[model samples]
Target: MKALVTTEDSGFGLRMADVPEPEPRPGQALVEVRAVAVNRGELSMMAMLPPGSQLGWDIAGTVLRPAADGSGPAAGTRVTGLADGAGWSELAAADTARLTPVPDDLDWTAATAIPVVGLTALYALRHAGLLLGRTVLVTGAGGGVGRMAVQLAAASGARVVAWVGSAERAKGLRELGAAAVSTYDAEETGPVDVLVDSVGGQVLNRAYRLVVPGGKVIVYGNTTRSELNLPVDWGHARPGVQLRYVHLFHELPAHPVTRDLGFLVQRVADGLLDPQVATVAPWTDAEPALRALAQRQVNGKVVLTI
Candidate 1:
């Protein structure tokens, strides 16, 4: 099978290589990957990955074989889900518990966009204790997880305030249900009931200060700054405010990955949620697609067709 692998000499730190096909384990299913999504986190780690290692986390495809334990969808079923790695290949071994059935009508590009980013947005909102009529602020709203957070927060009846890097990217954020969309440099003085932050560094610090006294602030990504600096008086100034950090892989066991991904897939099928695919290119163009993603040029999810 041809898979996208990390290479030390490649300019993008990635190249195509022939690799052995994966075999399903007792609780895993072997999937014939149809599409995969590119994420900034994975791209950032490319240089550090072992040579020839497969790289990707989100995938949508058909199940070629069921789990040995009889716990997952049968062979020939369409599915989409998160993988530990190796999703960039033509075949990937997916944990049955993390696999979600894809709607028959949904395209591979759209379905592939829902796994990692969708689950991250959903879980972040849940961690923040989102409630109807509450005010929610989402930073880095132009990115995949940020865009999903905006729409999901609004669908849940929260007033959403989106922070993006450019005015051009803020155009359709309101139509997606954001009550207000502003540049990251814009001032946001009002207190929010919940803050979902994907951009770390200064943005995270600023958003954290805006959470209401008893509200929660959930930090998920550190796209801008590797080292996040918080206010010196953060703990004392907002004693009641709860600060939580989410690493999706670590929380998968506590949450139902399959059930959550399935719900989001259904929402997309019903037109209530949008996967917001920004670019679709063949897997052969993985280098350029990854370059664009690393440059932060994409407004939404970027899918590579197999």
Candidate 2:
């Protein structure tokens, strides 16, 4: 199997080489890689660690085999979801309990887009009680998770007011179902029932005053700031209104876990969701895409064609 291997622990090394195929462990599934996407987590990981670590998380592929522990995807099936690492490879392993089935009609590019970003959006919208025609504002509305949230919340009957940093994205955000699209400005203000924040720091701090009383704020990823900040008093003084940080990985497998990646896969299999691929590059070109994406030059998800 050929894989993107990190040769050093620091942020700047990646080499493609032949590695042994991974065998499925009990409770795990083996996937023949098709497509994978990039995220800031991967960038930061590479920056912080030595090379030799496989760097990838979002993946969509087919189940070649499931572990003998009854983890098979009914033997073979098209599926997608989060993975531990080694995503930039021809093969990978994930717990059978974590893999989700993709829609038969969807391509791997689209299938690969939904899991991490989709789940984050799902959790945010649900936590905010998105229905009832509530007005919600999503920061970074044209990005991966933001676009999904915009579409998902709009589909659920929410009147959405979204913000993006660039004017070019405003039109698309509107097309995707934002009731209103505004250029993110610190002084801007509007009443909202929920705010799904992916871009943080100043944008997040400014968003504090926008939600209605008793409303909730869901914080997931921080794209704009490495050292994110919030006004403790921002949401504190408003009784019944609270702010909570939600990481999909942490919440996806919470205790008494009745739901997992399979839930997201079910939605995908049912045609309720799709991942938007911003760009697809071979593993050799991953670095430039990762750099551009990490720098915000790329919108939506970046997939690696294995």
- Determine which window of 10 residues in candidate 1 has minimal summed lDDT: 182-191
lDDT of 2 at 288: 79
- The sequence of per-residue lDDT tens digits that candidate 1 reaches over residues 71-169 is 989999999997668899999999999999998999999999998899888988888774698999999999899999999999999999999888867
| Best model per TM-score | 1
What are the Cα lDDT values of the candidates?
Answer: 0.87, 0.75
Clashing pairs in 1: none
Candidate 1 Cα lDDT to native: 0.87
TM-score per prediction, in order, is 0.96, 0.88
Instruction: Give the per-residue lDDT of model 2 (tens digit) for 140-174.
Output: 88778888888888888988878888886665677
The clash count for each model shown is 0, 13
